[model samples]
Target: MSTQPAAERETVLIRSARDVTELVNSGAARGSHAKMIVLLALGGIFLDAYDLTSLAYGITQIREEFGLSPAGAGAVTASISVGAILGAWLGGVLVDRLGRYRVFMADMLFFVVSAIGCALAPNAEVLIVFRFLMGIGVGMDIPVAMAFLAEFSRLRGKGSKGSRTASWSPAWYVATSGCYLVILALYFLLPDSQHDLLWRFTVGFGAVPAIVILLVRNKYMNESPSWAANQGDLERAARILRDSYGVDAVVAEDAERPKRESKPRASLHQFRTLFARRFRPRTFQALAVALAQTFSYNAVAYGLPIIIASLLGQGDLNTISASLVLNLVFAVTGGLLGMRLANSAGAWRMTFWGFAVQLTALVVLAVIGDPSSTAWVLLALFALGGFMFAQGGGPGANFMNFASLSYPTELRGTGIGFNQGTLRVGSTLSLFFFPVLSASFGTGVFWVIAAAPLLGMVALLAKRWEPVGYDADAVEHEYQQRLATPEPARG
Candidate 1:
């Protein structure tokens, strides 16, 4: 190695992965490239939310078309959740092993192909198969999307990592609302004779955005600089910083390579690391939040039209209008407010309060039973709107915050993957049972839904871990420090 001056090297060189991480953490990079990356990642999330909600209004139509029993309808509805369970579990590991760029690109094709297949399916069995494939696409996108959001942002202040991660909430609601708008448009535009094609058109439209995102992703998407550095590829990390973050980082030729973690490529052992002593509390909280949030959110959001129609004894047009208003006004608004407050109020507090509000809303709905009058119907609507508002702003947004922020870059994918995979189990159960439960129990199903947020509140009280404003990359910094310090000589 040529003898470079130590002082000069200190000033100009990125000596370790920690150096790159520090540059990112300091919020030095202010470039359009960074913003583009975040927008693209949000696009992926938008696709996930859109695809999931596309069939919400069409589920009854699908049942009628196929002459399906309740159990058969549940199967068709729950198929995606089943597929998502596998996708999240496997995708989480793959994103870590393969890098976010590769996995993200690959998952988009899943959306396109699955959407087309679902649109063309001739039978109920075939439709279920395509929906399962769509679920996989949805499941795979989340971990990678969350990774891109967290890695691209700074640790604190406005548009901080926490706030950026929470932005997924608004993106999701916006997409859900977008789905309803599409359905509403089709409701009026399609001829009466072609009304049977509504479900097909709605399901197929999901592919259009997926195709658009896929085309643009290649030009703008770059490997996460932190993920590049974590893999001991300082040269690649430096290039990414220069291109994406507007930082001209220099990697000295003679610098020692940053030590990589000994963790094996995505496996059960890798999953075990999430529950190791240091990460156990975080993992528990993440699972609790995800399980509670998804169980309730899926049940309520998927069944929104049914709930509205049942409450008001309204026709399809009225149900669609009510659902759209609830999503746009309450859900989307709450999500935006949550993102704004994430930096100041903290995720733990917001999530806890969100669960408390949802718990109360569900309890009120349970107490009210079925609405017999217009005023009672408004009260029921208010309760449902309250639950959506709380969910959008609180737990729905912050669950990803917990999954993505609680772990260092090395384990971020696996932590999010494990958490998401477990949560999908709850999602599957809720989707499969919600219709059955509502049919069997009538308005009493609200009491059952109340249990989800109550469980979340209990877990939050039990293990209080706040991921907001915490520096996950500090572990890397500490590791670099330990390496720099000389070992004590043997006595």
Candidate 2:
């Protein structure tokens, strides 16, 4: 059942267009299949999303349970990001070195472990520790999954079916919304006095998707041939094609070509190579886009529950649930819009316009919102939420499109890992600092948060290059030509 290398494993060099075409055609098969993978892969993120929103849900309870203050709850909440930082740093290296299919399956183990730990935590200290570990797993999954989605979509084709599968990411937003709904359901079903189990069940239910994925993963998951070929593993590459597409068999001679003898794989150095001249500009672009998306998206969406909860001044669970549902709806709407635009408009263009829209929304939010007094604040929040989807979700929709296009096939995964790793760092920083900034600065702090999208707009404007609808080779060739030209000698 397994194609484990026996004795000495040989790399298969794929030289035929026929094989590559077949490989891609097979991948694009069912419009819904990619969605299934997205749901499965994003299972880890669903937990992260649920846990993140639920922290707000569970925070009130935790504060009471631990006899703590707001600062203590903030500390517990931020710890997950610290853990995610560690996970993001290392997860990229591990995923790049290991096959995507294998890592895809194995990484879930971390999520499972952390979930159990979170559910069983005995003290505030212990809860924070477990939550951080779970965050690490969550942080690592996004880049890998995005790479998988992009590659799978490209192999499948960039058409309706491909679009359908790619759009599965919005399902995560839906799933995340369901998480809050679950909390509301549990609140009504369970006795008010039996609140102890609420957080446990909310966090625990996150594992169900992973378990379902585990069962189906073996049957459907195949190592990406393009990824294997990039790693210089031709035999493994061919085997993947044989297993997955069945139509793209490499010829024996090409399949048996001698593998290149290269330097020992340096995951760390490869990680840094992302910022080298060849990759640096786009690396920064990808990072900025991700940062803009994350900062704006997290600031507005995650903060929505906090804002609504705080503003309503002693609202029922239903209000909190409604706020979360609204966040999910607008977020999914943005993601769907991004999916529509991904193929036609450039990712950077979508990013620029999205951020521009977001900036406008945030400005309106700052001008009109009186967190304490204004009912109009909710209207701004909804528009801001919808605008945010385009900003982050648009670029977030296409980080892989840019990353995959920027680097050569051989370094695609490494490039993606490093790029994503950088974004995760930014995300962690944003998550950690936003609350502090908000507390010290007040609701008007959104004005400061508003600056992030502007920065994204500046970065996008200064470095804009259209990458959509082009093959990797053509994009690389253009970059090489641009790099080879001698810059005018400085005076």
Candidate 3:
């Protein structure tokens, strides 16, 4: 060995997976390649939000075309959530077993095929089937996308892993706004007689973005270096570190290689690992935030158009314009703010405050009942906007923070998958029941929705777990160290 001091070594020596994890946690500045990887991951999230919302404005048109009852419409709307439930569960496992790059690439095809299928469906049955397929893509994409965001980022800084993961919220809001913009454009662009085809066009357009993401994925995306190291491929991890993260790392000549697993195993035991003693509090906190956030968000954001038109008594054009503005202005802005403050204010604090604001907004909307005057309508709209603002910045963005940062690379996929899968159940219920409940009790539905945020607050108070500024991956590092060290010889 050269007698050079460690600091004078030409390349940083990566001896084990712990070295790789520490390097990643060091928060070194990665160049544009890292940025592109993050962008691609965010692109997946954008597609997810876009595909889910594409039919939001067109739900009525679809109901009219199929001559469906509220229950049928609910089924059509909830199909994707149902599909997502399975997709998240399966995708979580696949992402861990198959690697992030492969699973991320595979999910885009689901988007492409499902979008086309939904676009071309001849009946409600076909639409529901295709929507369910699309939902699977949405569900699968989130875990891998979030994994990419977290794994690619540093542990602490202005744009740390927590902040970067929170970016999914703004990306989601941007996509939701993009859907509305498309609808607005199509509303005027389509001939008066061809207006009925708007939903088809909107749903079909999702395929374009999906295809674009798929094509560019191979060029920019790579297996996460940290993940590769954890899988016992230190050489591959070093190369990734050099290429993707601008770290001049090389596996030490005398470094011990990790024992590779015979196969990538994903099983029920992996799922159960999330509920292990050390992770139980994190699991419960993440689940609470996810369930509450998705339930309330799906109820409000998905039903915004309906609320504007049916409950708020706005015309179609006004409803579209208003929904678009609320998302772009309040939701997008709030998400950006949340992303910015994630490192400063912390995910736990932001999420609690966000739930507080959402509760207040829902209560206000509930009390307003029917807006008898323009002022009351404006107040109700303000309340809606406030809720969106809170969600965009708080739970909407930071839910991912809790889920993604609460585990190491080994369990990250499973943790996020479980959280998302369970939350989608709430999503399914909210989407399925919103129309029925709204129809039955009018604005009283807001009272029911208010409970979601309250539950989130309660969970937060009970758990007191804060993922921000915490090194969850340290657990894996410690475990690896223990394994590498020989056990003390028994006397």
Candidate 4:
């Protein structure tokens, strides 16, 4: 018997985590369980953000310390991005196959070891290896965190979970600004005499946050009821609900319902299932958005400060301060706009407009080329600002939303993983190529960067499904129904 429902209505039999999920989704249950899970997720995201941007802050210092060339610099910088691609792929399989708890806590160790390794590297080769290791932790964290948040958060017409997921985008902004702040503080505190150690400190500082996430996650985490349900363990699902959320659930008396079908088997051919027609569209849509968003973001947004510094012939110190302020304003404004507009503007609409804005900005930047005059520099800055605002609010906010909403819990981790993995692939390619091309092409690099969003537009054109406020259970059920019903053979 249901604790609250027993007195009011006939007690509904509890099923898998799916049933518990319905309770939470229906507002029948509410408590610290969901909120705490979101906190744990946020902590992971915070570190994910921190580790990403911290490298850029120290790029120049690392370059000089190791006597590296641009090619070497790109390789060292992109090492983490490449590692993330691998980690994300593994996370997709691991989180879904091994339970979220196992993968979630274990990856933090990668961050600690990699951070320390980067800080203490004897040579560029060692730094690259460690960065690659750290990248794996960063890559694995997103799918695990996103899947957990998607499964657990209370969402109604774009509720906390969606907000929490959207909050992940701003983590980039937070990371960018935080790195700058750290770098600035270090510069002032250490004086010119000790500034040589700045890069090491910045790279190492990320461990503090990763350790915090690992610690808090220890106390507040819960096994996902939905994931439990997906595994067909109804009792464990019910117990988790009652124990963690205080929702007393009972097994249903009868197994008959008007249109019930068995839950999909927890099969291991995740990649194959994804390509099946029923799921292919959803997979493509999520993957497209992720690839485009990362391509645009890494190509322009991540490297913006470096580009600016190069144009002005400003030293690392000035670049840090300038990019930091720019990112703070951009992050707050764009991230706020994305959150405020998520429900009203809708996701696909934002994605469309985001790509358009980035494309326009890139074109303008190309035309302006490297900023020789003050006027040209300001104009290019304005264009960059437009791209950032549009991206943070649009694709940046919506890509992960699409990834989170695309599939059922059974494949959700893998689904998000594919999105994230492909995302890092795009990011890694962009990060690697952007500098090489930038050096060769100067402002023409914007023209090249502009091409990514154009491809994103092609992906968006492939199909349009706006999933901002839709329930994951309902979405999954709808897919199941389609799978149940036979369709006419196509000519």
In candidate 2, which residue ranges exceed 4 Å CA deviation? 1-39, 42-48, 155-169, 254-256, 260-266, 312-314, 371-377, 391-393, 473-491
Tell me how candidate 3 scores on lDDT.
0.91
Error of 3 at 5 (Å): 20
How many steric clashes between backbone atoms does each model show? 0, 5, 0, 4
lDDT of 4 at 310: 77
Which ranges of candidate 1 are over 4 A from the true structure? Answer: 1-12, 258-263, 476-491
lDDT string, candidate 2, 360-457, tens digits: 87787777656555567567666666664664356555555666556654456676666656666656666656556666765686798888889888
Which run of 10 residues does model 4 get worst, by summed lDDT? 255-264
Residue pairs with backbone overlap in model 2: 11-234, 11-235, 12-234, 12-235, 28-156
Candidate 1 structure quality by residue, lDDT tens digits, 287-374 = 9889999999999999887677764577889888888989999999999989999989989999999999999999998888878788
lDDT tens per residue, model 3, 1-491 = 89543433447888987788787777653656778999999999999999999888888889999999989989999999999999999999888877899999999999999999999999999999999999999999999999999988889986699899999999999999999999999999988898899889999999998899878876678898888888889999998877776667889988868578753477888898898888888998899899999999999999999899999999979999999999999999999999999999999999999999999999999999999999999999999999999999999989999999999888899888999999999999999999889989899999999999999999889977889878888876677579779999999
What is the alpha-carbon lDDT of model 2 when measured against the actual structure? 0.63
Tell me the tens digit of each residue's lDDT in model 4 across 1-491: 46555312444467444566677666555557667877677678777777777777677677888898888988987999999999998888888877787788888788888888988999999988999998899889888888877776666555555665776767667776787899889988887977889888988988887787777775577778777766666666666666556666666655222221354433457877888876788788888788878987887766766788775456767677767767788754787678667777777888888888889988998898767787887788778788888888888887888888767778888888888888898899888877788778877778778888898888888888877777767777777679889999999
Candidate 4 ranges with C-alpha deviation above 4 Å? 1-13, 158-161, 250-268, 478-491
Alpha-carbon RMSD, each predicted model? 4.2, 6.3, 3.2, 4.1
**Higher-scoring candidate on TM-score, 1 or 3:** 3
Error of 3 at 208 (Å): 1.2
Clashes of 2: 5
Best by TM-score: 3
